[model samples]
Target: MSFRVGNAFSDPRVTMRQPQPVVLIRGTLNPAHVSAFYATAFPELASWLNLNRIPVSGPPVTLSHIASSTMMEVAAAYPVTVKVPTTQRITMGTLPGGPVASLIVQGSHEYLADGYDHLRAWLGENGYGPGPVSWASYIRLPDEHGDQRACVTELSWPIA
Candidate 1:
């Protein structure tokens, strides 16, 4: 399917989201491995949930800690209906959602820095201050072994 490139909500707005629970795997990855990482991580998470009879609650979310041009420390997660026990490589936690500034970045994951910058700028322009954290929830991942240009990434920043 073709993905369009533009703002997530067209007109940016501050919205409140309820807390969500997720099953996540934290790891370090370079830009080159982003696609591969998600490709491998999601299915593995899904299989684990399926094996344990857990139900999915929301879309996949990638919580980035430090994303530089060289490396990124990220938590790949899928929201779950109930609390799930932690595994050797995976853990469960709640994403405390409150007021947020959000947008959509349609393209490769490598350009996400620009997207984040854009959100920060918007927050500043509108007199909204950023909170301690931010995250990217993937709406559409790139095709397996396909071009990254068609990817659709959603970015959200906690704001006050």
Candidate 2:
């Protein structure tokens, strides 16, 4: 399916989101291993959810805890209607609710850095500082052929 790009990034906004229950897998990964990491994590998460008969509530999200040139500490998560007991590598937790600076970007995942940069600038200009965690909800992912031109990601940073 094809998705159209939107102009949502033109005006970044701060909105309140309710705390959400999610099932996730956390890992420390090199930049080069990010794709492979998610490729494995998502399916495993899905399988566990499916086996447990849990319901998914929204798109997949990546919670970024720490990022640097060499590595990133992140969690790949899926919102769920109900929290489940932790199993093996999968953990259940709630995404914190609060004022979040958000922007939607359309294009490759490579553009996400630019989107974050934009949000950082906007936060500085608007008297806001980033909170402890940031996340990206993947609205529309790349197709099987791995073309990312049409990917849509909502970039969000909790504000302090």
Candidate 3:
């Protein structure tokens, strides 16, 4: 319910009016309690949205999934590399661009929500009240280190 008196575009750090695409990655966290961690995130994120003005909702633990969005790249889309050419003639790269909000969190999944809290707070205080943009998860493709405990992911939401 809090709307800022002016536009948030005054800052270069905040990008407004752009297009983006969706991406997903399998995630594994330390202590293996990502479920419980995300569960605690929603309620706080909800309040942060209102306190700002973006009017975002859900991301409820019910979905059982989450992602971060980055600028769309059709050629780079779909991490599942297709070595064989498709005979079925289909659109290959139709990526889009737009405004987006993003956040980075380090450590365990339990702390993901905290970083989100910080993001929402910064948005509310800055300007960019909740806007329309699919929440695209673009976490780094797992590293070869074979250490699931050190996995890291970036959470992004596209906007315009």
lDDT per model vs. reference: 0.77, 0.85, 0.36
lDDT of 3 by residue, 84-132 (tens): 2222321122123556565544434554555455555666777765443
Clash count list over all predictions: 0, 0, 15
Instruction: Judging by TM-score against the true structure, name the best candidate.
Output: 2
Which order, best to worst by TM-score? 2, 1, 3
Q: Name the weakest run of 10 consecutive residues (lDDT summed) in model 3.
A: 56-65
Alpha-carbon runs more than 4 Å astray in model 3: 1-13, 16-18, 21-96, 133-138, 141-149, 158-160
lDDT of 3: 0.36
Alpha-carbon runs more than 4 Å astray in model 1: 1-11, 28-40, 67-73
Candidate 1, run of 10 with poorest lDDT = 1-10
Query: Per-residue lDDT tens digits of candidate 2, residues 43-131?
Result: 99989889988888999999886667798888899998876889779998777898999888887888788788888889999999998
* Candidate 2 CA-lDDT value: 0.85
**Model 3: residue 134 alpha-carbon error in angstroms:** 5.4
Mind giving the per-residue lDDT tens digits that candidate 1 earns over 50-116?
A: 8989888777897765556698877779888887888899898667678888877777877778778
Q: What is candidate 2's TM-score against the reference?
A: 0.86
Which is superior by lDDT, 1 or 2?
2
Q: What TM-score number comes out for model 3?
A: 0.38
